[model samples]
Target: MELPEEHSLGAHRRVSEARHTISEILTRSQNEHFAKGNDLDFSYVSSEGGRFRVNVYRKDTGIGATFRSIPSEVPTLEKLALPPIVTKLCDFHQGMVLVTGSTGTGKSTTLAAMIDHLNQTRRLNIISLEDPIEFVHASKNSQVIQRELGTHIPSFAEGVRAAMREDPDVILVGELRDADTISMAMTAAETGHLVLGTLHTTSAVKTIDRVIDALPVEQREQTKSFLAQSLLAVVTQVLVRTPEGHGRRAICELLMMTKAIAKLIQTEQTHQIPSQLQMGRDLGMQLLDQALLAAITARTVDPDDAYTYALEKRAFQKYVTDTTMLSKLDSLAPAAPVPPTNSTD
Candidate 1:
């Protein structure tokens, strides 16, 4: 598939290499391939020293692979155009901070940047658990120990469980993929370690909901209580093309754990949290629509594209040239969401 120029992930062209050559690349990238249908994700160091996270697998037709380049240097918050609120989220000594988004939405990159910031400025020891680790960090002000899934550790839950015993001041759970991992990470947070993690959720409310929902039905309230206490913030983002169509930038929403917000979470009143965010602007809270509106104002994103990610669709209607979207938002009894298109980014 030919990726659009505005694609934030990678690869504009389809693979044209010979099957044997592609197979060779896959084999050399990872010593041994997984079963035909299973994706083997591993990082590859090119002969020239560039890095890429590759997924090699087989499909109905034949072998298939996808490569996402990894920069040798991890970007700083300033470089990513992230608000200072994100850096502040990293400053907390203890609590859980989640950087969330769907696949290819730059959650991993954002996490790496936050970790890079901690690595450069803090004196604490940081431990990271990743699958096919992307960016590599060298110890600077802080000591960083990165463990790969199936390499140094068995699973994220086990890795996080083990990190607690390792005297770590900070833990990075690459993916909060299961219930045990989420619960353990929260436990670590409650015990005075700053735990950072990622989820496939697209909003702060949904992110909180997902955590509680992932637990057993009987454990939801307890998990909610723990999350209300331990969660520091949730920064959710999406990368979209600029109106000029030259490049892409991340639009993010941040929710700092204020007392009111905490109370709402503790009581499972999550749907009303967005109102708290809007009122807590002076306290550094942000909403996805607010971010999207800002991006539209700054000419950083196309109006139609921004509309797809906007929670308050009416807010974006003025900017969008297409009146049909506005009609969709207004014409329904209760407006339906304007869903986003599929993007590797």
Candidate 2:
């Protein structure tokens, strides 16, 4: 059979093919007694070699599907073009490491990479509770158990509570979406398990606020204390198309918890967390603008894109232009030869 032309495969064609494929997959899985649910989903690469994380839902007519590409292979920290500091978070044995960003910013991929690294290098048991389990990790040196939300358990909170009994060293909660899940995750972290999770927030401070605010007003104070004590780091990332226009790269804002940050969180003065991050480079903390500025100076990302996401736009503009800051940035950039001037007209 001839495949539809790329351009001719419009939304309708794509949707129709998706619906048909999903229905077929569901029918086959059901016939095999796969115990698929009403909201059955799976992640796989297509025949064309495009990786996809898909959701199949039962509609009135039939099954409908929505798919997101799961890059063929997991990306290394360098392959993703993330900053070096990102790896530092993985060094911690116990605490919470959060990857926060807007939807479609590759948060799941980043978390998977970290978990994969641990699975390969650390001889520990890792338990992941995902709604649909996006990435499938094979057991390397570590034992990996991936439990799906609806199929394996009723919810994230239940999965987390049950993971405690499994004696997992590392727990990956797909998302900290609600109060119950967040509270359980905190408990896991405080009890000496390394908890990794994602949040839909733009900045480091906002990520902190989102967690604390997820709890009730009366519980806010105690929640802050719990977070301040167990929080290890928050990595907020954004995908920007490269200036050369090849593809995309991530610019991350990493907030490493420090004494100052902990104090601020404990005192309920999270508004000051950004400034603390701005000044706490000694602790490996950085603001989003700092990462953007570095990307801009290296010419890895466009200046406008960097400026747009910068938390301190004016400071970022000045840092990109200020001779002192430029000198520092230039030192960080890759070494390149000076261009030769033309002698002949």
Q: Using lDDT as the measure, which candidate wins? A: 1
| Model 2 alpha-carbon drift over 4 Å, by segment | 1-18, 27-51, 55-66, 315-345
lDDT of 1: 0.85
lDDT of 1 at 120: 88
The alpha-carbon lDDT assigned to residue 60 of candidate 1 equals 51
Model 2 CA lDDT for position 110 = 89
Which ranges of candidate 1 are over 4 A from the true structure? Answer: 1-33, 322-345
lDDT of 2 by residue, 1-345 (tens): 122324454845865685455556454654244334456556656678776677655554444457777665667776876766777676778989999999888898888888887887789999998866777788999999999776787889989999999999999999899999999999999998999999999999899999989999998888989888899999999987688778878888889888888998888788998888788777777888877877888889867656666755556655343356456555766788999998986
| CA-lDDT, candidates in order | 0.85, 0.80
lDDT of 1 by residue, 226-313 (tens): 8778888999999987898786789998898888988998887999999998887897888989988988898878888899888767
Residue 246's C-alpha lDDT in candidate 1? Answer: 83
lDDT of 2: 0.80
Candidate 1 Cα deviation (angstroms), residue 60: 3.2
Per-model TM against the reference: 0.86, 0.78
Give me candidate 1's TM-score against the actual structure: 0.86
